[model samples]
Target: MGSTTIGCDQRIAWLLTSARLLNPDPELARRDGFIKALADQGIKIDNSRISRWESGLHPVSGQVAATYEQALGLTEGSLVAVAAGLRRTFGNGPAPREGALRGADLTDGDMDRLLELIDEGKGTGAHWLRLVGQLGTYDRVYLRQQEWAALSARLVQELAVSVGVGFVRRYEAAAGLIRHPNAQRHLTRAIGGFVMNPDTQVVAPVLSLLTEIADEAAGDLVLRMLTSEDKNLRSAASSVAAVKVSRGHFGAHALPQLESHVVGSLRRGESLDGRLDSFDLAVQLPDESWERAMGGLRNRRAFDLVIGSRRGGELVPTQQTAAVVQRLSAAVQRDTPTHSPHENDAMLRRLLRESLLHAHKPRRHHAALLLAATPYAPAVAKHCQDLATHSNDLMAARALTVLMRVGHRMGRSRVLLQSLAETRPTIRARALVNLGLNPEPIKPAEADALLGHLDEHSRPVERHATMFALGMNGGTTLKKLAKSDTEWMARSATWWLDQGPALHDSDAALDQIGAQT
Candidate 1:
């Protein structure tokens, strides 16, 4: 409708102008005559005033915006919603007042609208897969009592035969959130079959969901799998029981290489945190009962315990360093003579430094994980500071997290902003989270990128990432986003605006959330 692509602030204004220009009845749609037509619809506004709005000089009231949509034969509130999204994104025009969306609670009408959307999308398997992420982010999803039984049954029917790892992950996330008894019954029946499925990928994720809705009878079913010879099934079951497996089926080949890399670095006395973060490197150490291979490593117990816990997924710096120091203190008290009380501490630092700049990504991931957990050393501090601007975005992002842990944020603000532009979604999402958690004011460029990145039509993973990024960045007008056509995004925005922002989004926490696949 316009000669050129409309920029950020021009969305609503462009929409209005195009509506008039493309109108079938030119006699009543142009500025002067449109005013008369609008006035007859009880929308009292002068022709010049309309021009000011269409020219992007000012904004109309929510009522007028809604009325304009209706008068232009557009859906009611369509313009108003776009205008709100535009203002929220660009800080353009004035903020909506009476028309602005408020609160997180869904009204009956909102719930009905949601059911309608679900009904429309239900034909496609993608719809059910999407709901896994969509419904997961909401503070709460309400279905009127009458809608629950049928909906849950339909969900169970879909879950029963769903294939593919992507579908499994979405279903796992969704199933974890569904605890209602009625849903649980159907889900249990469906999930039991998946757990016994031959494919490791199928059994692995389903096993996680099984424990969520698994009942006493299901326990007998799981019990037999516990003794099963299938390594993958045993590993998944072991995970459920909060026990360790000697060699887990998942990431089996990766672990020894990770542990071996770190051990080699330990022998050489160095490792860098940057190396650990790039490759999603996480390795579980043996419990004290089995004992760590390296007797001189004082941080072994801490290392084993951190990874041993049922919820422990990755190592965070603060916890690791604290545990290392505590072990060192205990060793000194016991007059232990294996080496300096801090020999293990020094060994850990050396391990990190040696691996920091390693060419291999897998080795780097291990070293970075270890580096974050262990105490900081001046030698590696410079490497992290330097790595914040490294060509490797992974290293750079990890450097940001490690530096922030040590109170080194002031010098890295520019690097922090650059991180927001990283091409990798994983690193970019991590940086956006870092940006949101940090207290820095949002700059116009950073703000624009954040806004532009948020599209309702974007993939659920990326869309939610941007939502948290923008909302957590602070001082955002979320009313429009809170009512987004994308239900999941809308629920996320509404939750953020109402309550989610105040919750802590620490680097470790964000890492966990952002790492969701």
Candidate 2:
């Protein structure tokens, strides 16, 4: 079969006549009014053009044919046929098919009915929910706002906190409503009131309510206000608003909210000169499986947002980005029980790079901590160095603890040895005692260095931490320590080593050691 081209002038005539027939309100295409409408739409054409085609005085041109097709929102072939039929029936009066109506011709009453379905409380919430689920339905303006207010509230009131959060999040995502600042303010206030109420019992329900409002404003600037400087408001808001970024369907929305809460709290703390304590920095991932999936993504937006919050940056003043990074980094360190391998890998890589290069002290400190805890790998080596060499004694100490942890995870004695070597004598001795609890074989020189701390250092805590590290490093090290100027260090190290993983199976061994001896 071959394709046939339709003339533009004839296509325009058919389109105009067809529009008049389909328009229940006859004013839509009255006489030359349709041509004027086209002209108003930036399409240049006159009634003569239609008349000529209708009279068969001229064939329509291709450009005109395309213009008419787009202006009428009709398929090219459909418009061509309608034009041909118009030419054939001009003298016979307008074609019968010209009077036919599309669904767009629904009367005012039909529109009312559709709106009623959406606003029907318990009856319509699920309906709109299902309606929005259908592809392309979200683009319809009338359909989108039809029952939004009522449906959104009901969903918040009905579903479990997490479920409601997910559903509303999905809806707002489809509608792309998060960018509107006005909507965000109204939404934040409405939902924030519910969730921020200290008397609320069921966190899920309250969380659901806030989640509902947040959906309308998932990406709004109002998100930054959740943890604002009102001392009472921040303390009250942290509980309900505190969220974790698990990897999956909930991730796209939940992660942003989580990031907002973190930054908000951090900024509040900074404003108070670091007096504010309760920030809800803890985050619980769904499971180990999710870690791999969630951890692998860079979260560059969140990262950049926090980085800019640090002093001297390009982006908008988004609270204190460094504080936000520290809060998140602290959560990753203290809270995550597990993350998927992929997510863990990605998170570790980014954290190491960011920490090494970051100019901010608090953010760099936390980043170094996260890197220290991560398993030793080539990509992360620089972060370990940055932490060890850090000017802040506290940060360097924390980094050393993490380095040992990473070395332990990798089952690499060399990394542990080098990490201990990089530390100052006091720090090295302290670290050695920590190693004794999980002691791998240490070099004779390292053992001697740690032993010297036992008699030389007055701080019992430092001496004990070094002794523990030495015992855990295993070998004749602790027995060699038994010959120390004071036998208590050897005895303590030996006793702890005997207990091994069983010393405090219920709690963390390092924590137990720190507390006990």
For candidate 2, lDDT tens digit of each residue in 249-290? Answer: 234455545544454444441321121122222122233323
Per-model TM-score on C-alpha atoms? 0.31, 0.27
**Candidate number with greatest TM-score:** 1
Candidate 1 local lDDT, 333-360, one digit each (tens): 2332222223333434333432333332
What is the alpha-carbon lDDT for the whole of candidate 1?
0.44
Which residues of candidate 2, in runs, are more than 4 Å off? 1-350, 353-376, 408-440, 480-491, 500-517
Each prediction's RMSD to truth: 23.4, 26.4
